[model samples]
Target: MTTMNLPIISSCSVDGCSYNHDHDCHAGAITVTDAAGAACGTYVDASDKGGVDASGRVGACHRSDCTHNDHLECTASGVEVGAGADRADCLTFAPA
Candidate 1:
């Protein structure tokens, strides 16, 4: 199997997200996007609920303007997800 060293989702406050459980993220990986604002591209509706036991990691980041973005990858020590204007957002996102 291929190994990937990606940033972790340290915390999440969007209890309505499918990947959020007990204020933590359990998805295998997540994608950060900025289509409308810095947000979690992997977020799903509150009705959906499914994720792994372990915490989620950043698989890809499309917010090129984010300071932690490097070639579409997140370079932050860890990321936080929570409710935002886009529904779910990357709290760690900051402009470069």
Candidate 2:
């Protein structure tokens, strides 16, 4: 099988986000989309107590308007997750 070159989630500072592990994102990958701001569509509230054990990676993105997205994949080497208008957001997102 061919492997995909998904971007890694470098860091996340949203303490209440389920995918965050010691300031790092633990989801396999994340999708970024436009909400009130550049939001992390993969972000789940830790109150729900759900998350993956592996390090986070950027799988698919819906922000087709973002400059860093190509074919729904993030081209950035890495991404940062942090608080936004809603909750967790992709800090590397840039509008195209």
Candidate 3:
């Protein structure tokens, strides 16, 4: 299979998320969109104590309304994670 260069998660501040380890996202990739006011869309509740070994990349962006969204994938080189109504959010989202 052809390997795609996944987008790098520049930073994450969601301490309570399941994919967060040492303030970094461990998901294979992340999705961004408008939900609960600027949400990460990838945040998952952690039922365990530790995180996975994988680092998160920007996979699909549901915000077809965002300028950075191309074919549902994020075109941004990097994305910043921060606080939102749901705790984690993709800060790079911008309305198109």
Candidate 4:
């Protein structure tokens, strides 16, 4: 079986979301887009945020048909970010 490693959140995309620190994603849950570059409307937060060694990682690609959805984790190689209603960002994006 192909064992793929999950992506880690390095920063947040939402501006002033009370989870971003210098472009670093610190939110417990983050919003991401679909394979068609559309917003998935899924916000995932980390259980442990702003704490001692808090590993803030968001995984919301639960769709089985989704290419990025790898065992409930986003395996998409690269992701884009923007400041609009259609904007989307992946917290678990990694290069194939």
Candidate 5:
């Protein structure tokens, strides 16, 4: 997994959700889902601004051994985005 020194927001937008710990996204695998869970939030339109919404709509895997993961954040440079079967939800998720 690559390493990202980027600083993400201190809290998640999900209401009543408690996955963040001291501004560190420790959700293991953050899940990004629409209100209806119909599609992954990471699926960006090619025409979207900035290429994608790296902060608001992407998912990440915090698993210690995942090659594509890095401390709960995506280290693919500007591709802080990820896709998932459940609305781009974090596949390596863990309850707070």
Candidate 6:
């Protein structure tokens, strides 16, 4: 099967998130948007850490209004995650 080249998470500023490490994300893949308005659904604010030792990528995006969204996937080269109105949000999101 062909592998999908998902969008990379260039950076993340949500220090409270369990998956955030040194301003970077470590989840294998992250999901953004839905009812949360480009929010990072993968964000978790627990005292304990989670995820692996690799950079995160965008596995799926539910913001159909976002310019980079295509078929529920993110088409951007990369995305930045940070704290916004929500705990975590996609900084690269742009209205379509």
The sequence of per-residue lDDT tens digits that candidate 2 reaches over residues 1-96 is 112468888888888887777887877767787676778888887566455776788877788888998877788888888877667888888889
Tell me the deviation in Å of residue 16 in model 5: 18
Q: Please report how far candidate 3 places residue 4 from its true position, in Å.
A: 4.0
Candidate number with greatest lDDT:
1
By summed lDDT, the worst window of 10 consecutive residues in model 5 runs over 44-53
Which clashing pairs does model 3 show?
A: none
Q: Score every model by TM-score.
A: 0.89, 0.84, 0.80, 0.46, 0.25, 0.90
Order the candidates by lDDT, highest first: 1, 6, 2, 3, 4, 5
Full ranking by TM-score = 6, 1, 2, 3, 4, 5
Task: List residue ranges in candidate 1 displaced over 4 A.
Answer: 1-4
> Runs in model 5 with CA error above 4 Å?
1-60, 71-73, 80-83, 89-96
lDDT of 4 at 67: 58
Clashes of each: 0, 2, 0, 9, 6, 0
> On lDDT, who's better, 5 or 6?
6
Ten-residue segment with the worst summed lDDT in candidate 2? 1-10
Clashing pairs in 1: none
* lDDT by residue (tens digit), candidate 3, 14-66: 77788888878888777776585557877887766454576678877787887
lDDT of 1 by residue, 1-96 (tens): 122579999999986888888888988999998776688988887677799989999999999998999988899989988877677899899889
Comparing candidate 1 with candidate 6, which one achieves the higher lDDT?
1
Cα displacement (angstroms), candidate 2, residue 40, comes to: 0.8
Question: Where is model 4 more than 4 Å wrong at Cα?
Answer: 1-5, 29-55, 63-65, 76-88, 91-96
Candidate 6 lDDT over 6-46, as tens digits, reads 88899999988888888889898998867565889888888
Which window of ten consecutive residues has the lowest lDDT sum in model 1?
1-10
lDDT assessment of candidate 2: 0.79
State which candidate has the highest TM-score.
6
